[model samples]
Target chain A: MIKKFTSALNLKSGHVDLSHGGGGRAMTQLIDELFIKHFDNDLLRQHNDQALFSVPAGRLAISTDGHVISPLFFPGGDIGSLAVHGTLNDVAMSGARPLYLAAGFILEEGLPLADLERIVISMAAASKAAGTPIVTGDTKVVERGKGDGVFITTTGVGIVPEGVNISGNRASPGCAILISGSIGDHGVAIMAGRENLQFETSIVSDSAALHGLVADLVAVAPAAIRCLRDPTRGGLATTLNELAKQSGVGMAIAEDRIPVKAQVKAACEILGLDPLYVANEGKLVCVCEASAAETLLAVMQQHPLGRDAAIIGEVIDDPHGFVQMATTFGGRRIVDWPVGEQLPRIC
Target chain B: MIKKFTSALNLKSGHVDLSHGGGGRAMTQLIDELFIKHFDNDLLRQHNDQALFSVPAGRLAISTDGHVISPLFFPGGDIGSLAVHGTLNDVAMSGARPLYLAAGFILEEGLPLADLERIVISMAAASKAAGTPIVTGDTKVVERGKGDGVFITTTGVGIVPEGVNISGNRASPGCAILISGSIGDHGVAIMAGRENLQFETSIVSDSAALHGLVADLVAVAPAAIRCLRDPTRGGLATTLNELAKQSGVGMAIAEDRIPVKAQVKAACEILGLDPLYVANEGKLVCVCEASAAETLLAVMQQHPLGRDAAIIGEVIDDPHGFVQMATTFGGRRIVDWPVGEQLPRIC
Candidate 1:
């Protein structure tokens, strides 16, 4: 009955009603036709409310993230893909190979069924690309106005290989700072698309999972890499400030060396915003030994996702724990923590 | 600096503002005075933006929850305690011993410092009660109108012991069903206290961490226990239906055997709600072998949190996955999965 309804139903254009989230025939059809169809995997095939699986040998790292981004569907990605990538990256940041994921959804009443299907399909695509299957999950509905369109919370489990020691607190003096690509694209894109804030030129969000890129870096420069961070909510400035406090160290960056697209810079200028503090979905900030800087850069550049990799700065010893950047015009100033949120729901 | 401001801040009768969520002097003051003071611990003592810790050997279970209740402070528990307890119980439901928690706060602009302090203190109290320390956390602020006062997200990690296999799919025919205590307290309390809903009777939410109760149960009835679940959002009826489907079995329950307070029954009757489908913050549903039912009930009844524990039903072989309840009047009817969300955002 469920298979028949889902197969014949127009999943994309339909809106969800009270019955969709009620755990009755409507919900069963939605799950069987939409969620189960897209998120198909061996573990999910068991049809159990909870998933059971074995882990690989080594130290394990676990991380969970909740996705409450407004406009659930965005240019580069939607809430579904972001949930998978955000959590997978968090677990991978610990130098772990992400093994599996569990997703929990809180759907607002009256959400479009088509939108839900789109998001779930995207999630399935991202998981397959990243080679991690979503093993278990839950779904519940909140009344309209009580919740945003949809909120997804994903939990990830992974195993770190032997002899790998990576932490935000591990950055030290003499470590070189490298960024995977241009920053602020995600923040600008979301802002422009959301508030209808326009720019002379259009830009897209940089939301992608960087675990594969991190794996490549670790395979070659494991010992040289002291720390890795995704410049997310607080963007580059906030992330660096966090790293400084974590390692009890200071940092010095050349503004000209940091990668920022001209369009994004222009958008920030027009909106009276700071690109340095903007969010980036796909980029990473790497802290590695100065000696292996070039080698690491070379490796990162070879990957399609890291073609714009650049040496943005270097670690420094400062008892005051400040992060300073030399301006492109040769003026120096402190790049402190953000005074307030740059974009409220950028994530 | 942060310590002084947090101590003086009153969460009750206060509103949030821009500075509270910002990372400026005011934000620092808020963190130092409120969050740091209530969440004092060695890991948090380091005062880094993120926390680092080590875990003991065993398979790990991780869960995360976001609390955005309408009223920040509610009867029996506030958002702060709910944030901690919700995630801790989620981890515990997997039969794991919860170890640590990480919290993230999203304070709206114009929120009072005192209100923040109260919530933080409550969070501290709940964490301490569960014997778990909040190791790391992040804070961000949004504009006043953009947010609904305050939102909290907590992530929890726990270690599962070896040789213990428990899941929703483990239910078998002839298995006995037991409930920890009374139900519908949380849902009814929230409803009565709601701004628009006015009711004469008073009820308190049963918000609590169940790790202690679980520890006692594990000590005596580990092997016989087939499934353990916390009836939160969809309440007992939804949870039972899920178990039946997952375990590929049927259930026979006694409506009179299920515990429901008079006030709760009245509230449900007036509102045309079913008490069985109402949420319970501090209750759990346990399914175990018939032989271990008495032992588990005795162990549960001895605990203060489980004083009203009772055997409500038994598992039966039925591929149709029906959950039938025999009423006090000797009539039997299907107690199916809920038709809709009885009370949204009850979690």
Candidate 2:
């Protein structure tokens, strides 16, 4: 049956029309040929509206993210990978190991089947690499001119391990802050692609699944870790501000220690954007006890995804709960949250 | 802080811009004054990327649905209620009691704040009424001309009680098929609103949450019920065909026994559309043992959402798995799945 449907689909040249998402034979064919073929799993084989499974006994963490990145395809990643990585990272930020994902796609009429297939393949690869299968999904099509190419919304569920309690409000005075790697790669890559901007060096998006890295960190120091956050949409500055406000603590970061690629810094300068506010898909900000900062940094630096991990700052006591950064030239300034978004649809 | 942010929002006159979904202060303001204000709960107040909660030990069912209904507002319900009901029904089809919902919104720039507020209020009301709180959500904005007004994708998680094993493939040769109520109201309401068509009587959508009704039916015949499906996008004909194929059996329906409202029938006739293929937001098709069919129908009819419930069909042994219907005109015909959607974006 699957072979018959696959043969009917002109995978190389056909385009998605209204019928592909019409909840009829065309829609079923597309799911069977494209989605089910790539994201095959036991639970999804049931072909039910929902997936039924057993969850381990523990606190569960569920997160949702909508990916509307334009151009669908980027240098190192596309909207598909970003959708999977973003939601999985969100679930990971809660100090949990992501278990499964549910994807919802809103496709525009007349989209090329080739492009959609590529995106689905990428999503399946990301899910497979992360060990989290996309167990269920729904698709809807809008008329031409009413929608962009494709907008994917992914929701993930994870199980929080015992003895692990992480939240934004767990940051406290004297806690050390660490960043996984250099930032601004993802934002700069997306901006360059959307605006057709060229640079000396092409900056690829840092989009990746971080659950494995997070698990490694938690294993080393579960009790010492205070909080874990992925600096995504609002970037490092806004993330720190949120943490400070939630924890009622001030933050002081040294600019020289924060990791930022030279090319990325140059690109942000050319675009007149602050790297502090640029998004990073594969980066994380870790808040932990000062005593465990060096050991945690060592463990993070050994991981492939966190080679450039650095201890960037420390928490402090301040009534205003301000996030201040020490400039490279010995100046200090408040790294406040941007009033408006510096980049929209970068994810 | 929340009060200060609320004062800053001109809720009556403001329009959403790209910044509102930019994950910055503007986005935070919108969330604080609008979404958080209405869907206020302790889990959301934590303001973490993911919500953490405890679930009972049992089989878990997770479902996702993307709602792209045209004309954000219709005669009976808006996109918000439809989003909630659609996801909840999908979970309930697995005989699960839905517990939590996660919403992700893709908003087009320049959408009126007032309209967004109304939609959010409706979602909150629906969630509250259904006893399912939307624990976490994400919002992203697309540039004007890149998206329609607003598209919402909701994912729900539920727990299936012990001794209940419901699936589409569980239907057997002797099972009887039942429908909850009149069909085609939702699709007709949407089509009329989009095309500016009028009828003698207003055709309002039957968009509603049916988990309570499903629970009532499940309680009466837990073991006797074979399968449950809500005829949403492809309506009764498509739904029956899907069930037949899944169960590897044939279905025979009496068209006259299927309930269709007078206004809905008239509207479909004028539009040259079939009621069997039109969408229904708040209806279900149940396949149960013949012995329990009468009892299930009685229980369903007592519920407000299923007052017009009727036994319309039965499953039969056939290798071909065809769905044949006895037409009102006394002719028998194969009720095949539509090749394409009759009404696009009808939810």
Clashes of each: 25, 0
lDDT tens readout by residue for model 1, B267-293: 989988888888888988999999999
How do the residues B13-91 of candidate 2 rate in per-residue lDDT, one tens digit apiece? 9998999888888888888788888988888878899999898777899999999998999989999999999999999
Candidate 1 chain A minimal-lDDT segment of 10 residues: A1-10
RMSD of 2: 1.5
Please report the candidate that would top DockQ against the real structure. Answer: 2
- Tens digits of per-residue lDDT, candidate 2, A47-114, equal 78999989866799999999999879988899999999999999999989999999999999989999
Task: For each candidate in the order shown, give its overall lDDT on alpha carbons.
Answer: 0.78, 0.90
Worst window of 10 by summed lDDT in candidate 1 chain B = B1-10
Q: DockQ for all models, in order?
A: 0.25, 0.75
Q: Write the per-residue lDDT of candidate 1 for residues A10-112, one digit (tens) a residue.
A: 6757777755665445556666677778999866664544454555444666666666676687778889999888888877777778888877676767788
In model 1, which runs have C-alpha deviations exceeding 4 angstroms? A1-10, A17-33, A42-59, A138-140, A200-202, B1-14, B17-36, B42-57, B104-113, B137-147
